[model samples]
Target: MKAEEMWKASTGKGVKVAVVDTGVNPDTPSLKGQVLTDEVPKEVSYKATEDYDGHGTSMAELIAGTGADGTLRGLAPDAKIVPYRVALTGLDKAEMQKAPHLAKVIRAIADSDVKIINMSFGGKIDLPDVREAMKYAHDKGKLMFAGTGNDAMETEFTGFPAAYPYVVGVAASDESGVVGEFSQHGNYVDLAAPGLDVPTWCDKTFRSYCTGEGTSMASAIASASAALVWSAHPDWTANQVLASLIDTAGRDWARDDPSTYLGYGLIRPRKVLENKDFNPGPADTDPLAKENFRGVVDESGKPVAASPSPSTEPSKGTETSDGDDQGDRASATASETDTSGNTTLWVALGAAAAALVIGGGAFAVIRSRRGA
Candidate 1:
C-alpha cells in the first residue's frame, strides 16, 4: 500500500513516535516538518531535532520522512518524530565498552506522551534494566518495535531488545519477499519487511544517501505502519492497535506455524484498516500470547522474567518512572555526535509537512531503492 492513500484518513498528525538511537538531525528535507519535540522530557540531555549518527535519521525517514530531495519516503508521513540520543557508539573504547544507554532511553520514551517507540539497535547481551523498561512501556500502552540484530554470518547469535517480550521483533527481507541470509532467525522474530535494498542517511552531515541491508530499516517500517493505524483511531488502546496488526498480518502459512525467520509475515495494515467493522480481538489479550509470547504468568500466577537468556551486565540505577523523552531512534534528532562509518543521509527538514500520503488501500506502488 502506498503511504499517500493512508494520509487521506490521517497523517499521524496527533500521533507521536519516539526514536531512541545515537541522535537525529533536524536539517533533513524529508524530515523537516514531521518531528515534534514539545512533549519530550527535559531531564534527558538530547534534543529531538538533532541526529548525530546517520542511522537514526535513515530510520526516521523510513517511518515518517516527507520524500524531499527525491530521497527515502516514510510510511506515516504526517507523524511526529521525537528524538533521543542514546550512547550506543563509543566515544572511545571505554565508552564503547560501557553498557548501552538503551535502558535509560527506552524508559524515558515510555514515560513521555509518545504512543510509538522505535529501536533499531541491538547487541548479544540482554540488559536487565532495559527489559524491565520495555515491560513498563508495554504496560503503559506504548507500541514498541526493535531490530532482530544482524549477526547471521558471525556467531548466528540472538540479541536483546528484539528478543524481549512485548517488543515487536522485526526481520529483514529482500525486494522479492525472501528473508535475507544475513537476517538472524529465531523464535523471537515477529515480522519482516523490505530491508535488503532500503535507502537511508549515510552520516550526521546529511551529505548523501546509501543502500542499507539490515533488519533496522524493517523495524522502522513496522513501527511506521503501526503509527498509521494508531493515528486513524486515536481512541483505540495500544492493545487494540497491536492486536489488529497481528490479526491482519499477511502470511500464506498456517496461523500456528509462525516462521522462526519471518514471524507472522509482512504486515498488511490495509487488511485491518479496510474493514471498518473489523474486530481488534480482546484488548487484554497479548498479541503475542502464543509460544514465544511475553508477559507470561508463572505457575504461581506471578509475573516472572520471561528472558530465557539475560544480559551479562548487572542492573544499575532505579528507573522510578515511565515517561518518554526526546530521543528518536529511526529518525532525526537535535544535533549531536556520531563516529560510526557514514551510511546515511542528512538534510534540512521542516515541521510536519508531508508531500505524499499513502494509505492502507493496496496499490501497485512502494518504490524500492537500490544501492543509494
Candidate 2:
C-alpha cells in the first residue's frame, strides 16, 4: 500500500474516527494523546475508556495509534480517535447490561463531529433499531464501515450492520490482495483490506500484542484509509470520500459488477492522497447508490426505494489489478432478524510475542512486520 509514502502525503491530521466496539483503553503507549475520550457523548460513554476486551483499543490503535515505543503504528497515525463502548460478545452479562444500546450509540455518533464510523463487530441477528440508526447516520453524511464477517467457511451468514443499506461492508484480505478464506462473501461486501496476520491486543489485560486475524482489523484499516484521504481533502463530504475510495480501489472486475469476495477489491488510499488533481465527482452523489438501493430488499422481499440519481459521469481512472472472479449480488432487508445474539467482535487471537514495557510500565508493546 506504500504506507510510508502515503504518510508523506497525508498523516490523517484533523480527522476524528469513531470506533464502535467493546471499549478502548486510551492509556496505551501508542494511544496516549490519540484518543479524545471527552468527545464521546456522555449518554453512550459508559466505560468508553475502559477496554474490557482490548478489542476496541486495538481498533483505535489500528486507525490512529502513534506507534510510540515500538507499538503498532496505525495507517493514519495523526488522526484522533473517539471511542464508543457497546456490548459486543465476550463481555460478562453484567457489563453487557450496563453497556449502551448499539442503536443508541450509533445515533449519538451520528450527531457528533466524527467523520468516519468503524464498526469492527458483526452479528447474525438484524435489529430494526440499529438499522434505523444506520440510516440516520447515512442521512447525516457520516461514512461508515463494518466487517463482512469471518465465518465464510461456516454458516456464511450475512452480518447485520454490514448488510444494512449505506454501510460499507469490508472484507478481510492479505498482503497479496487475495481475500481471506474466512472472510464472508455476499453482495454486501463493498471493499477489502489487509486483515490476516495483523498485530493486535491479546486481551483485556493489555499485557502484550499478539498476531491477530479477522475482518475487524480490515474495517479499522479501511477507516484509516478514508482518514488519509479525508485529511488530505478536508472539504470532501462523506459521499465524496466514499466515491474517491471506490474510484481508486484496486480491482479486476468491472466497477458495476463487483466480486462477492473482494467487492471493489483492496483499498488503496495512497492512490488518492498522492494525486493532487484528483476529482471526487459530486459531493452529494453517493458512490454506492446502486448497492444501497437496488441490492437491498424489504422484509417481504420487496425492493427498497431507490436512492437519488448517481453521478452521471462517474469518476474516471480506477486502478485495476488481478483479483477473483465476479459473482451474483444478493439483497438484504431492513426487517431481517435472527434469534442468535448481539454483535460479536471479529478478531481471532494468535500467539503473543515477547512484551516490552515502555516508560516505567505505562504500557506494554509488541512488534510485528505484517502490513495492516
Candidate 3:
C-alpha cells in the first residue's frame, strides 16, 4: 500500500476505534494523547487504562500510535482510540472475575460513538451472550474486526467472535501480501493484512518494542484501514466503508468465492483513499451479507435468519478478476503511480502457512511474536 500518499488524503482523523482486549496504556510515548479513556463506559471501565499484558496497548498503538520517540507508528496516525478491558488470558483468577464481561464490554462500545471495534484476541469456544452482543453491535452499525486465531496448523477449529456473524475475521499477512502460516483459515476468514515483523509493546512495563507476528496485529491493522476510509468519507455508513474495502481489496479470486486463507485478499486502503470519486454502493447493502447470513447458527445448532434477503452482488465500481483457480499458489503484481510522483508495486502472493494452538475456553490474546 502507498501509505504516505494515502495519508495525504486521510489520516483517520475524527474517527474512533474501540479496542476490546486486555487493556490499553494511554501513557505510552506514541499514545499519550491518542486514547479516549473518558469515552469508555464507566461500568465496563475497570483497569481500562492499565494494560496488564501489553497486548491491548500494542493493538491500540497499531491503530492510532503517533510514532513518538521513534516508536511504532499506526496506519491511522490521527485516529483516536477508545479502550475497553475484558478478561483474557494472563489475568489472575481474581482479576478475571472482576474484569467486565466481553458481552457487556461489546454492548457498551456498540452504544457509544466508536466507529470500529478491534478485537485482537480469540478462543475456540463461542459463548451465547457474546454472540448476541456481536449481533447487537452489528445492528448498531459498528464495523468489527477480529483475529482468525493462530492455530491453523494445529487444528481445524475456527475461533469464536471471529466465527460469529457480523465480525470480519482477519488473517495475518506479511508486507509481501502472503498470509502467515500461523494465521487460521476456514470459511470465517474475511481479509488479510500485514502482521509479521511488525513492532509492538513487549509487556506491561512499556520499556521497549518487540517484533510481533499474529492475527492480532492483522486485526488491528484492518480496523485502522477502516478508520482511514471512514474518516475520508464520514458520511459513508459502516456498510459503505466495508463495501469500499471489499471492492478495492487486492485479490486474484472472485469476490464471492473468497480465499479461505486470505478472504477477499489483502486489504488495500490506499486503493480507496487515493481515489476521490470512489463509489461505495448502496448504504443499506452489506458487502458480506451472503457469508454473514450463512454458517451462523443458534444455540440448538439451527441456522439463524439474520437478514431478510442477502444480496448476491458484492459491490459497485468493482470487477471480478479472471484468476479463477483458487488453488493456484502463484504471486501476482499490480503497479501504480502515487500523488507524490512515486511508483508503487503491490506484490499479491498466494496463501500458504502453519499454525499453533493456544488454550481454549476464555478469550486469549492471539499473540505470536519474537522479542526485539
Best by lDDT: 2
Q: What is the TM-score of each candidate against the true structure?
A: 0.79, 0.81, 0.80
Clash tally, candidates in order: 66, 0, 3
What TM-score does structure 1 among the candidates reach?
0.79
Question: Which 10 residues in a row give candidate 1 its minimum summed lDDT?
Answer: 337-346
Q: Quote the lDDT for 176 in model 2.
A: 56
Better structure of 1 and 3 per TM-score? 3
| Residue runs of model 2 more than 4 Å from their true location after superposition | 295-372
- The digit string of per-residue lDDT tens for model 3 on 34-133 reads 9999998999999999988788888887788877766666778899999988777667778878989888999999999999998877766667888899
Q: How far does residue 186 in candidate 2 sit from its true spot (Å)?
A: 0.3
What is candidate 1's CA lDDT for residue 23?
63
lDDT of 1 by residue, 250-277 (tens): 6656665666667777666766666777
Report the error of model 3 at residue 177, Å. Answer: 1.4
The lDDT values for all models are 0.63, 0.71, 0.70
Candidate 1 local distance difference test against the native: 0.63
Model 3: residues with Cα > 4 Å off, grouped in runs: 295-372
Q: Model 2, 80-170: lDDT tens per residue?
A: 9999887766667788788899899999999998989988877666677888899899999899998777656555466767878889988
* All-Cα superposition RMSD per candidate: 9.8, 10.6, 13.1
Q: Number of the top candidate by TM-score?
A: 2
